[model samples]
Each structure stands twice: as structure tokens, then as C-alpha cells.
Target: MTDPIRIDVWSDIACPWCYIGKRNLENGLAVAGQDDDAPQVEVVYHSFELSPDTPVDFDGSSADFLAQHKGISIEQAHAMNDRVSQIARDQAGLHYRFDIQQHTNTVKAHELTHFAKEHGKQLEMTERIMSAYFLEGRHVGRIDDLVALAEEVGLDGAAARAALESDAYLPAVRADQEQARGYGINGVPFFVVDGKYGISGAQPAEAFTQVARQVWAEHQV
Candidate 1:
């Protein structure tokens, strides 16, 4: 059997397209039969903060944040979010209620993802966190909130809290950032396939399937 294809993805919970890209990747895996009998493809989610400096309690709306950060108007932000939300619904069956989204920094949440990886629930926890942030209106920037979310994913709440309180797994988060920088990654939803091929943004599932097939074929030789 060939070695598993390694897929490293850099993303942020606050990034709508990251979530979309995740679904699209999953769709690609399903279509390619990579999820079934092919050489294994291990997925690793890395941290990339879209709003590292955002306050725990953001006073403004999502539109405001986008306007301030991207220099776009509120109307444009809403339109953009609407388009992405519709895409997500079609692609991932995820219903993103943009009005309910809580805009907060996700540094600590990313740290918790590292912790969850140790427990073999990294992907589950990542999905949960993203859903909490984008759909359920959970506060993702605080340690306490993260602990609660961790518990929902079958992790020990107290231990998760302690880990967050002590800055545990922070180095791992930084390491992810450093690795992205080394790879010249400047955007979220960046996918590196088999340590060589790079696919950026929320590309279609066919694109991912093509890349996966190419990488798998190369490994077979």
C-alpha cells in the first residue's frame, strides 16, 4: 500500500470561505474515493487568525468589521456574506446565519485545536468551533467559552479550561503560523497536498480531486 497523502490546511474559524473550503475538500475526497480504499489522506488543520486583534466583545456588527478591515461598505459586506452563505448552504449543507455571528479573535480557540489534536478529535473540534462561531453565536475568543465548546466535543471541560488558562498549545499555534510563513501562505483555506501541490481558496471539489489524484499517482511510482 502507498503512504497516506498528507493534506495540511491553514484556516480560521472566522473565515467563511475556510468553512466552505473544508466542505468542498470533503466533497472532493468523497468523489475521488479517497475516503474509502485509496491510499490514506491525512488531514491536518492549521491556525490562521483573520482578526487577531478583535476584542472579546465586539461592539459593532459583522458588517462594521468587514468595512473597517477591508475598506468596503456595509452594503457590500452584507452582499458578500450573503453570497458566501448561499454557497455554503449548497456545498456543505451548512446554514450560516450571518446576523448571529459573533465577531471575536480566535487565538485561544486555535490553541484548543492543538490540544484536541492530541486527543484525536482535532477535525471534529474544528468543525464544532466553526459552527459555534458562524451559526450558533458562541463567543469563541474567550478561554471559558472554548472550554465549554470543548466539552461539547467530549473533551474534559476542566482540563480544557486549565490548558487554555495556562497558555498550553500556544507554541503549536505559533508553529502553524511559522510553517505557513515558510510556505509563503498569506491566506486562509490554503491546502498543501502531499507536501508539494498548493491549492488556495474555496476551490471546487473537482480541483481538489484532480490534485489528489495527481499526488496519489506520483506516490504510486
Candidate 2:
């Protein structure tokens, strides 16, 4: 049996491109599978907080936060987001509602993802949280909100809440960040394939497809 390709992904809950990159990678893998023998794949998500200092309840829209963070005008921030929104819609088939997005510190959300990983619902949990943040405008920084999302993904809500309350998974989140630092990765949505190859940022589906095929072919040789 062929060994599965392990992809370690570093992403943040508030990152719009991370969601789009996830979709593009999935789409690319699907395309590759159709063109050749489908390779088994294992994806592991790690924590990367783009704005660790952000408050749990930011007092403005995503655009306002972006404006401040990037030191740009609110109008420029909106224009930047507009371009990204269009790209997300066209490339990843995702509808982003940044106007209503709750810009919050993702450390707690990252902790929840670690909790979900322990329960074998990491992927579902991550996807749901991203959707909640970018699409549904749900709060992801609070324990209560995260627990509700965990339940939506078929996890035990109470257990999730308990885990968050106890900071049981905060270590795991910190560990992931430490590892990212060792890897010299300072950005979200960074992809590491098979412990060697690094693909940064949100590339097109073709890029993922090509990389998957190349890595698979090399491993077989």
C-alpha cells in the first residue's frame, strides 16, 4: 500500500486566504486524483495566529481592523478586501462576509482546534470555525461560541467547553506556533508536504495538483 502524503497546514481562523487556500488544495487534489491514481492524503492543521493581540471583541468591522493593522486608510482596506472577495468567489467558490466578520484573537479558537484534534474532529472543527468567522459572522474567540461550533461538528459541546475552560489545549496551540517559528514560517496558510516541500500563500489549484503529483512520483522512485 502507498503511504499517504501528510500535509501540515499553518493557518489562522481570521485569515480569509487560508479558507480559500484550503478549498483550492482540495480542488487541486480532486483534479489530480481524476487524472492519475488517487493518492491517499493526510492533512494536519497547526495553529498560526496572525493577530494574537486582537481583542476577543474588536470594536469594528474586518475592514476597520485591517486598516489599522496594515496602516492603510479604511478606503484602501475596503478596496483590498473587495479584490480578495472577488478572488475568493471566483477561485474558491467561497462567499466572504467581511463586513460583518468578527475580528478577534484566534488563540482561543486555535485551542479549540487542538481540542478537536484530540477528538478526531479537527478538520470538521477547523472548517466550521472558518466558515463561522468568514461566512456566518459568528464569534470564534469565546469559549461559549467555540463550544457551540464544536457541537455543530458532531463533537461533545460540554467536553469542548471544559477543555477550553481548563486551557487543556493551549499547550498544543503554543507548540504548533513554536514549530512554525522553527520552520521560519511567519504567515498563515503555509503548506508543508511530506516534511520537506513548502508551499507558501494561496496558490491556484494547479499548483497544488502539480506538487502532489511531483511528491508522489518522487516517493515512488
Best by TM-score: 2
lDDT to native, each model: 0.88, 0.92
Q: Model 2 over residues 47-143: C-alpha lDDT tens digits?
A: 9999888999999988999999999999999999999999999999999998888889999999999989988989999999999998998999988
In candidate 2, how many clashes are counted?
Answer: 0
The TM-score values for the models, in the order shown, are 0.95, 0.97
Determine the backbone clash count of candidate 1.
0
Q: What value does the lDDT take at residue 25 in candidate 1?
A: 91
Scored against the true structure, residue 177 in model 1 reaches a CA lDDT of 91
> Candidate 1 residues 138-186, lDDT tens each?
8888888899899999999988988889998899999999999999999
